[model samples]
Target: MAHFEKAKSIHDWLDQRLAIDKVNKVMQTEYWIPKNINFLWAMGMVLVITFMMLLVSGIFLLMYYQPNIATAFDSVNYTIMREVEFGWLWRHVHAVAASVVFLIIYIHMFTGIYYGSYKKGREMIWISGMLLFVAFSAEAFSGYMLPWGQMSYWAGMVITNLFSLGSLEMNGIVEWIRGDYVPAQAFLTRFFMLHVLLVPLAIMALIGIHFAALRIPHVNNQDGDEFDYDEESAKYLAGDTKGSKVIRFANDFLSKDLFVVAVYLIFFFYLVFWNYGFAMDPVNFDPADGLKTPAHIYPEWYFLWSYEILRPFSKDIGLMAFGFAQVIFVLLPFLDRSPNVAPANRRGPFAIWFWLMIVDLIALTAMGKLPPEGIFSTIGLYAAVTFIALWVALPFITMMEKKK
Candidate 1:
């Protein structure tokens, strides 16, 4: 009887301390939740869960990877190909999840843009998302170096070399990152540290700030209005908000979040198991030898546009023209001025401009994959022409339409 009484007392104490009703009341009354947010809104929660997946799986990878050039590639094989238990499975999961995370993030950003989620009071949230994007890219780049394969070596060399212009020494940055003289023992070790530790810590801190800002400002809805509490329809709103966030200690915006996470996990597992995982080539397993260049040097999919832009230009033009083009591409959210946030009703000329930008990106990606010779040069020429047609012509077309 004494033991049972003690357990009952402890359970009651916990229950009283975490009264869910009190928290829900505060959110429902104080926060400005939009009544119509659907499954699309749940993506932010999915991103958070994916990041957690990466963090956990990444820790295990760091334990088995050797960061030195002499043994780095061998170490990877030893873990995935030979030694460590379930290391391969964990690695592929991390890789596939990284790709999926970016895909979801892009969709989330565009969804916010289309819905005008960045307007009015939500500016801080939008800005935070952009900063998070930069951080994520850095994290991915740092981690990409860990496998120490051929793709990793050349990709690092090519990307790091870009900063070599304008007195930013590529070697110095590379050395600092590597914690050594070259992309050797020190480089892998430092990248591994950033990939597994520092970057992840920064990402988590930013995520907390991002979610808190969203919560405080209240989630934006498709209709861009606060919920009506008096109407019979309003009762449905309350139930939806309550249902969406019914999880203990979770805010009203997080109920649907758990479901989104489950779907992501299922998709992630399918990819990891179905695809054995991306291979680091035998040629790249050997350390980068300056004397022999690989027949074709291609960047990973994400950076292909920039690489494609760089391909056609001469050394001088490549440095200035391609650099300017990329800067403009990154500044897209500011460039297009369609007051109509949704792509559908951007009037006449504005719609054309939007379509052109999409086409330009597709053309650039295609050009990037081709060699800088023969037929590809012609394709690059057309890509360059279309880029001019859109970036220059489309804006002018929009102006003319406005004038009319």
Candidate 2:
């Protein structure tokens, strides 16, 4: 009798304090989720989850890893070859997650472009995403140098050269960041902290803002409709709540989220287990020496297109050209001015231009990987020309559309 009364009293007290009615109303409210989002939409969620995996795995690795230039290389090898149980598994997971994160973000960015998700109200969201991309690239590059292999050493050298453009003039700044005449102890230590701490924190905060902004606007559908969005009239559909809100997170939507996450994990595991991690060249394991440069130093796969752009240009032009290419990617939202979000309605001129840009990127990536010989240089020139044409042509197509 005493126990029953206590339980009843607790239940009644909780019921009075909780807003069960408000919670129920939200769960029952129908959100305007885009039905045709497909696997690409899932990529953003996959990226967020994968970052979590990397963070967890990285923390474990750091427990045993050293960051000093003298020990950094050996520390990584020790973890993989001898130190902890399943240390190899942890290292491989971190590497694979890095690649997967980039792959997913790239697809997600294109999906945004295809849908024109960056237009009007969502421009800030797009900008934040672009920043995230830049941050992720820095994180990857820094982390790559930590393993202290031949590839890692020369890679550090090549990338550091980018900072040397006006080094003769900006000697103070360059030396401070490099901490020595070359990539040395301070560089490794700082990069280690950034790869594990600073970059990830910034990424998380930006991602939070990204999602908050997204939720405010709600998702744009295939038909370019949010809750009140109207396509034919090019107006808000009207008669919906003004501010953003979420219903119960425990309904049908939760199930779909779980399903998508599960599918991605399965794919991740297949790569992790079957493929193993990509092996650094045995030569890269050696310490950095400015006297000995590697025969060919390539940036990671994701940077290949930009690296390719620099390949064919003369030394004087390469860096400038690559820098210009990056500007275009950063300013893509402004460059594309389709009034409607969907590309399906975009005319032949716009459609054709988009495809041309895609092809140019592919060509550039291929050229970046190839030796700087006759065929590769020829291909790079063609790709560079085509890339410029496509970029300039798109705005022209839009202009013509306006006149029509």
lDDT of 1 by residue, 4-50 (tens): 23335664655466644556555544444554667788888788778
Error of 2 at 280 (Å): 4.6
- Candidate RMSDs in Å, in order, are 5.7, 5.8
Candidate 2: clashing pairs of residues: 149-284, 149-285, 150-283, 150-284, 150-285, 151-284, 228-237, 229-237
Task: Supply every candidate's count of residue pairs whose N, Cα or C atoms clash at under 3 angstroms.
Answer: 4, 8
Task: Give TM per candidate.
Answer: 0.76, 0.84
Cand. 1 Cα-lDDT: 0.65
Model 1 regions more than 4 Å off: 1-33, 166-182, 223-256, 276-291, 316-350, 381-404
lDDT of 1 at 383: 77
Task: Judging by TM-score against the true structure, name the best candidate.
Answer: 2
| Model 2: lDDT of residue 346 | 59
Q: Which candidate is the best by lDDT?
A: 2
lDDT of 2 by residue, 1-404 (tens): 32322335664655556745455544333433444455566667688799999889888888888887677777788755587899878888888888878878878887777766777678888888898888889888888888877777778767776765532445556667778767788878887888888988888888888877775566655555545423321221243322322222344445666689898899888888887434334466566666788777777778888888776777657777777787777676677765556553454466666667678888898888777789888998889767766776666675555421
